[model samples]
Target: MFNYLKELSFTRGAWLLLTTSCVALEATALYFQHGMGLNPCVMCIYERLALLAILVAGMIGFLAPRFILTRWIALLLGSYGAVKGLTLAIKHTDYQLNPAPWNQCSPFVEFPETLPLNVWFPSIFEASGNCGKIVWQFWGLSMPQWLIAIFAVYTVLFACLVLSQFKRSSGMRERNLFS
Candidate 1:
């Protein structure tokens, strides 16, 4: 199973699946924001950015999955994005579950000066909703809660891919040493 996973990581289909899944998630987020009339908060915006990172990683991997350099880059980016997104989602969930005057999220969204996402794309990146407000829920889970699960899955998959690479490399070294 581990060998299969290692081999799969070098295939285009795996990378395509990763890219397509991220695209679907992004589209769903936009739909929730516009079509469903759900406003995003600052935390949500940060999560979106993290998702974008994963998407870019997937694209890079898909471009050259067989290349070790590209695979490593993709793995690093995906791992970073997954961890960041998971952290943001947990914080967002905390804000919603334990609301207080001093423990609430800020009203304004602050992106880096070099990348003013809100200024460039107000409709998508602008954060006008309060983080403590539970505007939407499904199956008894809030948006942030759902996001936690999503990010967790992404993180686990990335970890597995990384492990597979290490295992494959070690196995190759062992074989070379014996020969």
Candidate 2:
């Protein structure tokens, strides 16, 4: 199992698969949330943004074989996912504030309520949505918990892949110098 994870981290196709799975999962969650009457909380949207970043990075990595750039982008995305997961976990577990900060409450793209430009940034990061509620649970874990697990795994995998690529590039450089 450990060896397989290492391999997946170094392969672009694997990265793409990881990203695609994340996108699909988010879509499924969204479908369940909107179609099934489960409104999302602020933490959920943060997770979505993190997943979006990874999805975009994976698409670019797949399309481009330039490992250095692709790996860097993936690392950035993975870092974002890690932070998002940590934030979600904290908000869901420790802080049980109902109706997250208004900005965190609404979708970033959809601003039902207008705020002054100076206050907009805080709204963007503050926790204010319904997604934080533990409406859906399995084995005592909530939706955000599941999301955090997935994103955390992805982040670790992405980091491993970046390291693997760096090692491979270093090896190639050494070989070229000796030749």
Candidate 3:
């Protein structure tokens, strides 16, 4: 069962689909912020940054799905984003669980000032709310909780994708050497 899933996940079309989904996820987040009037906190903004990284990874994976190096790059980027996201999600989850004094927490993170995205699209990338406000929930799981789960799964999948691609390249190399 796991093997089947691993094989399916490593396919070229699957890689493209995986990366496209990251973009869609980010779009949905923007919708929640803009369309739903839900403000995101600093942790949420950081999560969006991680998601943006994943989105870039997916776009690259989509453009060159069959290339081994592309797969490795995608896996690295995806894993990086997922791991970073997981940490932020965990922090958000803690903040939600244990209400902290706003004075102790920074409302918005300070960027390097060179990052124009936060300035140009403040509505999307900027943090507008304090952490610990559970404005959204589904099946009793808050947004950050869901993010943790999603990022954890993505990390595992990225690892598997890397392993699968490495095996494929090595196998091809062996076949070429003998032939």
Candidate 4:
């Protein structure tokens, strides 16, 4: 059942999955921001950056050989990125569930001069709208809740990958020693 973990370790498909997922996430975010006229908050922007980092690391990892140390490094970094995103998602979900006394309730969102993501990519990274506004909901859950669910899945997958690699590599070493 889990044999694919060892087999796929040498293939690019594994990293491709992460890369593809991140791209889809970014695309959906862009659609919401540009087409639906819903803007993201500061924390949401940070989440997007984390997702982008995962995407980039996944791409680089896919290009490396499976046994190479670089792939492990990339995987670790990607896992960290996913963890960062999940943390933000949890915070956002909490804020949505319980409205806090914060400046995020403003009618408009403004990016600090230090963070020029809006200026660099207005279409994707702009923060022109408030994050406190519960504008959209699907299946009775808000967007941040959905983001949390997505990140949870990624975290589990990464954990499984890590475990599978460790077990399989140790087994391989034992077989080599016996032979």
The top-ranked prediction according to lDDT is: 1
- Write candidate 1's Cα lDDT for 1-179 as tens digits: 66777788888899999999999999999999999999999999999999999999999989878777888899999999999999999999999999889888888998899999899999999998889999999999999999999999999999989988876443332222123
lDDT of 3 by residue, 5-77 (tens): 4455446677667767887888889899989989889888889899878878877666655455665677689
Clashing pairs in 2: 9-161, 40-131, 41-129, 41-130, 41-131, 42-129, 100-127, 100-128, 101-127, 101-128
The number of residue pairs in model 1 that clash at the backbone is 0
- Residues 17-100 of candidate 2 have per-residue lDDT tens digits of 866886797678668665776665665655666777777767765654345555566667666666666666556544343444
- Model 1, position 45: C-alpha lDDT score: 93
Superior candidate under lDDT, 2 versus 3: 3
* Candidate 1 CA-lDDT value: 0.90
Native RMSD of candidate 4 (Å)? 4.6
Q: Candidate 3: where is the Cα deviation over 4 Å?
A: 1-11, 102-105, 168-179
RMSD per prediction, one decimal?
3.9, 6.7, 3.7, 4.6
> For candidate 2, what is the lDDT?
0.59
Q: TM-score of predicted model 1? A: 0.92
Q: At residue 58, give the lDDT of candidate 4.
A: 83
Which pairs clash in model 4? none
